[model samples]
Target: MPYLLTGAQGQAGRRLLSYVVSLPLPNTDAQLLAAVLAIRAARGGVGNVTGTDLSTLRLEDARAAAAALRGLGWQIDGVLFDGDPTAAVAVTIPDLARETGHPLPVGEKLRSRVSGWVARTLTAKPVKKLPPAARLAGLFLAAHGTCDSAGQIPADLPEACRAALPDLLAKGFLAELSQDRYRLDEAVRHLSGVRPPTGGQATRPGAVPSSWPQFNADAWARWKSEATPALRRHVEAVEHCALCALPVDRVAQAFMVAPRPMVIAKATMGAYGKWKGLHPDRGSLAAEFTVAFRAEHGHGPSYYQLTSGLGWGLDRSLGAYVVTRLVKNEWLVTTGAVPWTLRPGPAAQAQGIALPKARTEAPGDVPAAV
Candidate 1:
């Protein structure tokens, strides 16, 4: 499992990732890799401590990345947010783990925050009178503060949640501060268990709190007059650790604790040695073929004469597997079938190759121009 740090280019996000990665964990679990995956679109950086950089992914690409992890039976430990958390909480790492019965990493650093979010969410009252979307909007406002100083909704908020902002503020979870802007009340903030930085300083006692610059006098009066705020559920619990309830195996896997290399080497030789031969200076057989095919024929080689052409005595399945890998890596593109044809894909084009006509594409099937 990996920890995702969002707004990763920001100072807070970078600091949090740095701190989280430095914490020590038990060295016998492979469930957690001791690296952090940081994401940001502006610079298109996604990398882990291992120094593997998958560059320039769109923000929406994070979902695909997470899904790929899940397919491998790994789950995200948590997401450290350095941006608006309104949408972040909806896909909260803890919540996703709980929903899917996957293990969630619970480092001492994040346990308190996770528990707090769980407690707050489980106890939050729904605005029964409002539609479902509006109710969630109300909940988000109550949990996170109103829009930022510019009165703009957090860019990270889901569209549906953004649509509910107007109705939520009408009820005072958010008090109108200025034209199209708002401020969350102390009551809502308290229930959410989040305190904004006071005076642009960390949330410390004695720090002056940020004031609502355009607080509506009538709205404040109406808010104070309400008999019970009536907006939140008056519920509380002992807040036992959510991780404690898991079975022993599940609990053991919760934190992305990684095993030492020696211990891993003992478990399975191949698993530990998988990365031993990946020399950056050399290419694999598939890569060599991809390059050769693109240079010679301006496309991927067909498996029709795999044994002789590949010089590896590969059978159809093995040959197909190799081709599949090339396709997956974007080295080859299948143009058509009948005899099956392949063309140089984006990876080849990226290499500055000016593709020419390939005799291998079948004489009649060949296009007028290369």
Candidate 2:
């Protein structure tokens, strides 16, 4: 059987040729006598390699090559070897000829039959809307037979083209399976004149045949090791509430998807309005509470009121812990000894907390207490 190399001028092709040549073969080895085919019409000093420079060689060209070989009284086999790891595809020569079932083209035909297929595909209605770059990328992937039936792009696609996957998927040009992997839909493939290899089997893309890369666990561990510290520091710095010196995880758990502000009725704003008007200047949770309490009851929130406002299911001890932090930070202070009425401190005022207008009535059929 003879071997055909499609990307003969490419790196993979060069590496494959070098590797094949490096193999120790005895002079009488029958396998070493098998032919190596190239498309360029020159031996280029390579004794075992022969080719034709038909860049647009199609199925008909293959037949013509077969016929020409027969005319020379030589036997030709259809086996073609593609060296690209991601695009290694096997084709049954007779099956390809039978499936395509077209007469061979003759002299003076400048464009090969495959070029016509590509032209028809590009002008097809479904692919006509694709941007030029995306269309080119999609067509290349399809033609290579690397993309799966589900439209998943090979993991090894160039990074720049990878970014276009979402748009391609959205427009029905590709389907994403996971990170950096996409497939072209069947319609797109059919319209683009791209066909799966004969017998419908292929080696896994991005892997050497019969072997896989190292375990993903190592990569995951490395990423986590690097990312954890940076994430912890950012969470601590960004969410360190003055009133609650809770741990980073705790704050994230409570507020990451926290619910919207509670809707309280307006009729309940009587008891809190009798105290002196106070405005909070800080932008912390404690300052927000102080401002809200002052607007509702003319004073900062007491421990119980603050605890209820938390709605975080913390017990009084935890609530007291928060209060202690606020007091230590000089954001809040007790104004009355009997009931322990809370009031904003200089720090809270300096943070720009301000009083809100008193509401006489509630909106949306609810009393505004908060």
Candidate 3:
């Protein structure tokens, strides 16, 4: 309930669920649930799931649900049933990996929000103990409903889900249920997928305010015109990134500013002392993530983006420390103080990990390979 979606976010979430339901996989509620989670977590067509995620579903047969996913050509590595319950298992869904015609084409932050929404809605008090069919039905209805609580059953609602409608109504998850029409109860309107009206003004979620001082279009254009080919390519990558879609001013400012030396605080070092113990393979993991991240986004990730994408769950200070350590160890590299330029360092390259050919070929006097 704490994860309310903005107008754009709601639409993106609805599109994601709709895309998965429309796939040719089995229409069972269990498979539907698993697919939603997998697709939401996926980046570059790969996502990680754990035994705990499966067990929390309380499905009649978790293995069977996973098997059903595999039937649709999803490659799920590792044994979900036999492994350590907390170990992350990577699930690769080929369709999501495509650069073009991507079914769920949202940015990383939006995807994470939708994934969190699915988890929270499924586990809400009214539906957590419900059967898989009923729970899945709840998800569809909530996603299709509006801020006003009105919704029509989707045309593609699975046959099994249709039979579970009465259970949702009985459980108070639905305020009313007629043949093809239904309304979500007031208690769960936050989970509605319908975009709320913004009084006619459209808003981009992360856009910079117009008052920002550094956004000079003429200056940016002039800088690009004067920049070296390598630097120009790097600037374009940041400016044109589809995943970040950053404001022109924000992109311009980062490149316009001179690189600043990092000032490591005592607090950050203290946090790092405790944090490093939890991650034994931090160097390799950080290095590998940068490669995958650049392949999809066309630019390197910032410190926070790198840690979050890897599911390291570090706060800003600790994340900085970790990245600093990786840089020191030669497992990751950056372009001085440039934003979003974290890539594999020499150590990783020595281990057969490096940037794509196009990226590696263009190296300017930036003191790093992005």
Winner by TM-score: 3
Model 3 clash pairs are none
lDDT of 1: 0.33
User: What are the lDDT scores of the predictions, listed in order?
Assistant: 0.33, 0.35, 0.71
Model 1 over residues 203-228: C-alpha lDDT tens digits?
A: 42222333435445464435435513
> Among these predicted structures, which one has the highest lDDT?
3
Better of 1 and 3 by TM-score: 3
Quality of model 2 by C-alpha lDDT: 0.35
RMSD each, Å: 26.7, 30.7, 9.8
Error of 2 at 81 (Å): 39
Consecutive 10-residue window with the lowest summed lDDT within model 2: 99-108
Ranking by lDDT: 3, 2, 1
Q: Can you tell me which runs of candidate 2 are displaced by over 4 Å?
A: 1-111, 146-156, 191-370
- Model 2: per-residue Cα lDDT at residue 337: 32
Worst 10 residues of 3 by lDDT: 197-206
Residues 167-229 of candidate 2: C-alpha lDDT, one tens digit per residue: 667776665445745565655544322222323222211111222233254553354356334
Q: Which parts of model 3 are misplaced by more than 4 Å?
A: 1-3, 198-370
